[model samples]
Target: MQMNDQRDINAPRAEVWAALLSADVLKECVPGAQEVTGSPEEGFEATVVQKVGPVKATFKGQVSLTDMVEGESLTLSGEGKGGAAGFAKGEAKVRLEDIPDGTRLIYDVEAKVGGKLAQLGSRLIDGFAKKMADQFFENFQSVVEGPADEGSEVAEAEGTDEASKKKGWFGRLKG
Candidate 1:
């Protein structure tokens, strides 16, 4: 699957770049992510749990940034395994541009799945991927922007309740 989109963050380009590289921010923003370790200089290892259609998976992965142009753009690539569930590997090219309002983050991602996850069909996987990406960006925006403003554009951009929806029906059932 592939995804390309952009989001405006209410922060300077440098600050947004710093936050994107922070392990703490990554752990908090990445959907279903449980932990993140290591640094941008080397690589980061992460563990995440996600539910897709009827499957629930815990994935352990390693991610590294390449083709970097500090504060401008970089390529992130990673691979993860979910035991009997499946495996996923992908690469994303992320770029930051200065906008009058703030920094605009543009990203293009290509990903593939295998094993049981592949059996779930492309439509389901694509939907799940899109949802996860939206959640990640929304979370990142909130974190970078700091505390909420009742009537701010950030608050009104997307409803909090919708963003917090259950990952999948199977996840609710399992819980």
Candidate 2:
């Protein structure tokens, strides 16, 4: 499957680029991501849990950044195995452009699934994929913008930790 999207963040392009490369930010933004280790330069290893339709599984994967052009753009590629549930592999090309409001993050992704996951209908998988992507971006945007008030700051900090513990993975195919 293929997906493309763009979002405007209320932050400078440099700040958005830094956040994208930060393991801490990725851990918080990626849906269902339980743990993320390593850095952009060294690559990252993560464990994620996800449920699509009737299939639910845990995936361990490695993602590496390639074709980087400083703060402008980069490509991330990775693959994961979910035992009997299935396997997924994909790459995403992310581009950051300066916008009047802040930064516009545009991403194009291509992904494939195998094993049991391949047996599901395309419509089901597509819907699930879209939903996962939406959730990921929404969480990411919230993290980038941060809390608007001091009182909410404390709550946001505590909530991020709790949310990470409860969530599972970015998506079946996202690396």
Best by lDDT: 1
* Model 2 stretches with alpha carbons more than 4 Å out: 150-175
Candidate 2 global TM-score: 0.82
Q: lDDT tens digits, residues 1-175, model 1?
A: 9999999987788878887787888888889999999899998999999998999999999999899899999988989999999998888899999999989999998889999999999999998888887788888888777654444444447655534322322223335
Each candidate's clash count: 0, 4
Instruction: List per-prediction Cα lDDT, in the order shown.
Output: 0.84, 0.79
**Clashing residue pairs, backbone N/CA/C < 3 A, model 2:** 31-169, 32-168, 32-169, 33-168
Residue 121's lDDT within candidate 2 is 78
Q: Candidate 2 residues 114-174, lDDT tens each?
A: 8888899788887777777677777777777664445445656777543322121221112
User: How big is the positional error of residue 174 in model 1, measured in Å on the Cα after superposition?
Assistant: 40
TM-score of each: 0.84, 0.82
Find the candidate with the highest TM-score and give its number: 1
